[model samples]
Each structure stands twice: as structure tokens, then as C-alpha cells.
Target chain A: MAAGKRGNVYVVVGMAGAGKTSFLERVATYLERSGKPPYIINLDPAAMRLPYDANIDIRDTVDYKSVMSEYCLGPNGAILTSANLFATRFDKVVSICDLRAQDYEYFFIDTPGQIEIFTWSASGIMITDMLSAHFRTTILFILDTPQCQNPQIFMSNMLQAVSVLYRSRLAVILVFNKIDVASHAPLVKLLSDMSLFQSELEGVSDFSSTLTQSLHLILQEFYEHLKIVGVSAATGSGVEEVISVLEDVGAG
Target chain B: MNVFLSLRSTTNHGTVLSPRRAFAPTFSMPYAQLVVGPAGSGKSTYCHNVHQHCASLGRTLSVINLDPAADEFRYPVTADVRELISLEDVMEEEELGPNGALMFCMEYLEDNMDDWLAEQLEGYMEDDMVIFDCPGQLELYSHHSAFKSMTEKMTGWGWKMVCVYILDAQFISDGTKFIAGCLQAQSAMLHLALPHVNILSKVDMLQDKSVLEPYLCPDHQRLANELDERMDPKYRKLNHAIASVMEDFALISFAPLDISDEESLQFVLYQCDCAIGYGEDADVRTSRDVEYGDEPDMSNLSLE
Candidate 1:
């Protein structure tokens, strides 16, 4: 990110049940097809099964349940604590990635189910910082299309996207997932056309919606800078575009 | 439970209302379940299952969507948080990150709980059975004050609140994961300070029920032995320490929920009801049952 990084780091994040795992799996396949076997990392200690085989998994170095019993922490605390412990040893992970940096062009990191667990955690901050220092990092912020169909939910989703974009300080690729369930055309319109969003916001009136209208106006510039696309993780449609966006941003 | 109900026959005569019928029709005090769990743990699914379960039994349950990002919920949402604050508005308005924005949304909900929530509750009838399918965000229940303050408010309003903490059946199938689940449940229990029920949800999806058998009964020795074998020798003491806490204090035990099975759902709800003392305050309905002491003859009871 500072200058010319060797490779790209794509951090996939979203609300729970937004098809993050499936999307990552599809991305892995797309990468493999392009002859770029991306280095994969699973940062979520509590995840039971990973759709893709991660080259470096936090589970190997940290046991979530052991963290709980040893530290007398609950499941969530153990997750955050385990992630923190894993973060301490993350320099080694970065070194390992460094060794493989010449062999792979892309690195895909699958985060935990809850977006905040990783994004708001100390380990998450450290890992991302370490990776970005050596790589051109981008956040693949996934939004479940159906969840955003409601004008209210869509406004919230965009605001969430802007938050991630600003926080990561990395180029963001807004991904509207589950297109098979719902079309993302309306969501695209709401994000790009402030007037259209205003009309839709009129139907949902509350303190929140009024604030949402103001956000629609304020985020008009943010909309101009973001790269958004739709893909059905189930069908694997539009997964290739994610890679293209990364390449374009990574090149620029 | 039967004893408590059958004893109701002896307490107060004709005007005495049974717990099952206590709030019916008149719509006196409200009872609610604050459904919470880790991500993908079926908090929303449980609400849907309960809605269907109550429907078959000719009862109605109101579902309040407390998650701003919620969509495609199976149950009808009576009240939604989007009315109060959207996570998007907070994010755009404040230029905070998604996590920080969500925290703001929750804090906003907490700040206005007395008024906004009270107005939200005005639509629901008194004595209603309500379910709050909360966001899967662990922060809200683990250490946060939103749910705790909301619980306090409801209690202040003369409402009976029960905290239903759900863990995935697959999550608890392993000994190590079981300990984690127990500790997590205890955190919410301590934080909310309410009657709590830790449930092993999605039991129907577990392939090998035997893997979860040890936890189903909470076998301390087997879990510790497995934990000891699975973890490194350096953590051997820590494993024993955690397993011992789970077993000794017995702070948590799980009720298995095979949501697909109607009986399983009923059993889970019944456990929650008993925890809240749902029918303990019902009045005596009949003098005939006053003669019944240790046992009521099953054959002598009228069908009604």
C-alpha cells in the first residue's frame, strides 16, 4: 500500500449469513482457474468448516475451546482472546507469506462470521496492518442482495460499506451477493442515484430513515469512488469481476 | 410443572385464572423471550419455529426484529429496530466504521429504550408471549449493557423476561467446544441477570448424535479426558481447569432443540416458561382439586 507491494490481499467481510464462505469458495475456484493459486488464511478460530483449504489456519496455532477453559472465557470471549493470541504469533504468518509471496499473486483471507469480531478486534487490526504494509490490500465487503432490498436495509448496508472502506483505508470492492435470490439493480440505483434513493427513503419514515436520507446526500461522493458489482455465490456468477476489480485497483 | 398446575385447582375458586389462561383475552402482564446466540446459531430460525409451534397449538407469539440488517425472516415482525436507527444512517452520519456504527445503533436503542421501546410495546397486547430475535452480534449480550438495561426496564414494567441462549448443536458436539459454549452462556447469564436457558439448537442436523452424547448429559470426566488428549501438554492444566469449572459449578446445561419436531420445540418453550415462573402465580380454579393431594386420578378428571 505504501508503494509497490508484491501481491494483493483481499479480506472478505460481511454480516453473518451473507454468503461470505460460499463467496470465498467461489473466488478460490476462480483464482485456481486463472492459474493463480492464491494463498489462503482462515482467521476465524470458531469456524467449524472452511469451504476452501486455508494454507495457514489460526485453528492450528490456537484452539478456541482451550482458550475458553484455560482462561475461563465464554465462547465469544474465547474467540476474541484466541484471535488475539493468534495475532501475537502473526508475525510468523506474515513471514511465511513472505516466503510464498513469489509463488502466488493473490492472498484471500476469510474472516469470522460476525464482521465485528475480526474488524473490531486487536488481532484483526494487527493482521490487516501487517499484511497491508507488504501487500496491496482490499476489502471485499459482501452484501446479501435480498437483505438490502428493503430501502431501509439498503441505506444501512451502504453506510456499512462506507464504514469498512474508511476503516480499512484500503480500496473496497462492494459485492452484492445472492443475486439468485434477488436482483441488485435497485440497490445499485439507490447507491449511485441520490434522487432515486431519496424517493425510496420517503416510503420509510422514522428518525432512522430521515438520517438515511441525509446519508444518501452526504455519501454521493463516496458512491462515485466505490467499485460495486453483483454475484450469486450459489451460481458463481460475477465472481470473475471481483478479480478484475482487484487487478485494476492493484495496477492503478 | 403438573404439580404446580394441578395444585392450582385447590388455591382460589371460580375467579382463579390458570397460568395458561392468565393473560388470555384480557391481554395483565407480558412475558417475553430474548433469543440470542452466536452468528448462524439459529436465533431467527428459533423464532420462526416458535411461531409455527404456537400456531399449531392455537396461540400467538409476537416476533420483534431487533437486528437492523435482518431480512427474509419467516415470522411476522411486529416491531423492527430500523424504525429507531439504521446501522447505515449511523455509519454515514458519523463516518464511523461498521462495527462502531453498529455499536452506536445499539447505544441509541439503549438510550431510548424507555420511550421508543415502550411505544413499540404499546401495539402488542398485554399478557402477550413475545420473542425478540436479537442480532447475532456477541457484544450486545456478552458484556454490553443494552440487553441488561432492556431487561431491567421490562422488569420495571412488571414483565417477566427469560433469556434463551442458543448454541449450534455442531458447536457443542466437541468437548472443547462444549466448554466454550458453557462459558459463553454464563457470560450472558451474569450480564443480563435474568432467568437463562442455554439451548443446543439444530439437533436435527447433527449426523452422529453420539458425538454430542457426552455434552447432552454433561459428562465431566469424558470431556476433560478428551480435552486433555486433544490439547497440548502445556495446556493440560488449563484444560482441566476449564472442564472442572463447567462440571463443578454446573453453571450451564443445554436443552437439545430439534426444531423440526413439534414436541422438541414445546419442551424447549416449557423449560423457558418454568424458569420464568410463568404459571406459578395462577389462582386456584376448583375446590374439587382441593381433595386431590399427592395425585389426581387421571381417569376422574373431566375432559375440559
Candidate 2:
């Protein structure tokens, strides 16, 4: 497939088990069938198994098992060590992507499952910087939908989303995942109707009622303009809507 | 002639070979102490509790009060940043209100890292542990560069710190809420990039542990299904992705800690200990000098 004139790169990021890989697989299938499959790169070092074929895999370059065996590390240590190693040799990863240059419509980087490796580590930042330098990357933030049903959890997730936006400096597309099993009405109601959470927001802190109120008001202002889509990767429901949004962003 | 030549060569030739020995393991204490969590998550309380716990154990630990708006603490502090940058002062001087002032205080602290934090931590021993009672602001751990910069500076000072993230157990009862808590915990973990331990604090406050039991030892697939069942149908796809990611990555399980329970506290502490490789240097000793007497006669064992 020839590269689309838009030439967009989307990075799907979330905590481990956030369904990033599954979504990528489905998206790849969808795009492949549509004759525009994305160039997918798997960056997780500690992944013992995966469901999809990665165009580029970090494991091939850095042997996580050898690092564990040679260094006497547990799983987390090995993952961190492998991430550090990738950071040291990220140029090779860039070259791998470059090899597939203009071969696909988009480059979808499947990040490390550990959120910390992508968000907090210097290596994560370096990867983002390198990707941004090469292509216009937008972050597809997959949020657990059930977690957002409650006001407090929603607030915390919002904080995390904001954090990632600031840290990665990528245009964020927030996707509430796992909606097939949960009551999306309450969350959709919460996001759609901001007035319902006024008292709840006020109740979080006494010192910042005015501050909180103003912040809430500001959030509502932005919320009205924001595009939030809920989807189920398992059933393929709402996947098209998500793709449309991605396409729009890519075009933009 | 060949025998004479071999004997002469053997007598004149010599080889020097050095045998290789196994390298000894090296251990060094952490240089930094990181207290992290959301606002009102009992970060300060945990710091104080840890201080008291260390004292009771006859261990020397110092507390650094990093919260500029902090009014009181249960532990004695060796150094405080309020003296350097007060939230009230930031608000009054810069005309910024509470949130802005808190950010200002953090930025101010960041600006003076060398003079303020370095000076405070200067006299401490290499192995000395300090508890940094941080502010309650969520952004400090989320996106701000101030905390990251501080961590870098601490690491530069030879501190091998672990970010102790405390979430209230009472709040994390349901699968959905637990997932949310895990994301926040994950955020802090990601933002800090240091060794991290996710603690479900205030376990003592829960009258019944049944609600939190599953979350303590979370099954990702089960939680994902529960989460899907609870969310609105419109977000089913989103819920699935969230569940799948969680199930796929195993990103968000927590070690529950009831500070009031010694065993719970000890378990959490043990996790932290392993994170920093704490007891790696201790000498191993075996006791084999005990002698036991055969006791077939009348029992002489005294009940004291």
C-alpha cells in the first residue's frame, strides 16, 4: 500500500493489559483488508508472548532472558534493564522503521506494556522525541472504561491523561476501552453532562472549592469541544468511529 | 640426546598462570527517599508512621517535610522546605492562589535544588534513609518536570530511591475503582521511573475485607469482565481495550498494606527492601553449637 498523502504516525499507549496490542492487531487487520495496513512495531522487551506479528520487535535486538540470566534479575528488573538497553540502541529501531519507509499508510508504534517505561523513563522520552522528529505522532490513549464510571476514578484517569499529554507532547486521542461489558451510560452521562459532577467535584477538597470549581468549569469548556469515543476491541463495536477520528487527526 | 634436550628445556622453562576467583557482591544504601501519592492519600501519615517504625526498630531515619503547606506532622523532621518556599509566601508574594502557589513552591524548590535540598541532605551518611513528605498535589507526580528534575538530582547525589505510592484501600473496593486506582498508581510509577511500590493504605479502616479482597490479588480477566459489566454500553469498546491492556500487560495489581497490621506492614516493607536490594551485603551465619540432652527421665523442662 502506498503511503497516504496525510502520512500520519499514531502511537497507542496505556498501562499494561490496556488492550493496546489487541487493538493494534484489529486495526492492522482492518487496514490490511482495506489495503492500507500500518507498519506496527512492538517495543515491549519482557513480553514472553504476543498475539500479532510485529514489523519490528525489541526482543530481537535485546535478549531479555539473557539479561535476566546474566544479571540475576527478576521480571521487572529484566524489563527495566532491557528498556535501558533499547534506550542505548534506539537508533537501530529508527532504522528499522526507516526501512519500511513509505511502505504503509501509517506507522503504529506499539509501546512497552509497562506505562512507566513509556512515560517516566528517559528512554521513553527519547523514543517519543525520535518518533516525533521523524513523523507527526499522535497518542491514542486507551483508558479502561469501567474505571471512568465513577467520579473519583474518572478524575484520576483524567489527571493521568493530562499527564501523558504534557509529558509526551503528542496530540492525545482518548479512547474509553472495554465498553462492551460495562454501563457506558453513566460515564457518557458524566462526560456529556458536566453539571452532574459539580457537587461531587466540590466535595473533593475544602481548600480548593473555588479553585476546583473554576478548574471544573474550564474542563467543561474544553470537554464540550473534545471528542471522546467508547469502543470494544473484542466485539469490534465503535472501532470504525475511532478509525474515523484517527483518520481525521492524521489528515489534519 | 632428545631426552637430554627435553630435560634441559624443562629445567629452564617456567609458566606463570593466575587463577580467577569469583567476584564479591557489592551493596550500597539508597541515597534518596521518595514519598509519593495523590492528595489526602495519607503520604504524610505514612512518612510519620515509617519514621516511628524505624525508631522503634532502633534504626536511624530522618524525615524531610517537603510539603510547603504542611501545618503539622506526627514525626520529627530534620529538614523542611517550607522554610525555603512557603505556599503561603508564594501565594502572597506572587499573587497566586492555592494551586498556583503549590506549583510555584515546587518550581521554586526545583530552582534551588542545589542550595536547598543538597544542603539539607549534605551531612547525611551514605546509607542514611530520609522520608520526603511530599505535597498532596496530583500533578507533582503526573506531568510536572519539577518532581522528575528532583529525582534526577537525588540520583546524582547517589540516592537509589523507591517511589512509595499510597492509595486508600477504602476507596479501591470495586473492580472499576481498583482499576482507576491502578492507573493512577501506574501514572506515578511511570512519571517517577524509580523503583516503585504500590500500596493500598488504610486497610485497617475497612471493616470488611470482602469488597477489597479480589482487588488485593486481582485477576485481570475477571476485573476486566466486571468493568465491562459496569460501564455504559456506549463505552463497551473502550472498556474492552482497558480490560485487554490490563490483562495483557498485568499493569495494575497492588500489594495491600494495613499499616496497623504488623504482618501487612512487614510484607510491604519487604517488597520495598527487595526493590532496593537492601540486605544483600549481610554476612550469612549458621549456628551449630547447640547441645541437646536426652530426656527419657522425669521432665525437667521449666514453664516460665
lDDT of 2 at A159: 52
Model 1 over residues B54-124: C-alpha lDDT tens digits? 77655667899888655457888888998899866776799754445667788899998856786676544
Computed on C-alphas against the true complex, the DockQ of each candidate is 0.03, 0.03
User: Which candidate has the top score in lDDT?
Assistant: 1
TM-score of candidate 1 chain B vs. the reference: 0.79
- For candidate 2, write residues A91-118 as lDDT tens digits: 7767666666668667887876656556
lDDT tens digits, residue span B1-304, model 2:
3333432342243311111101112224344568887555678778877777667655567999988877767889899998898876776799753455677788889998867776676555434677788875555675566888898766654567888888777766566556656666765655566878788777777788667767755676786678666643544444455555555555556667666755555566556666775544422212231111221221211100
Model 2, position B205: C-alpha lDDT score: 78
**Residue B24: error of model 2 in Å?**
19
Cα error, candidate 2, residue B60 (Å): 2.0
Question: Which DockQ value does candidate 1 get?
Answer: 0.03
Clashes of 1: 4
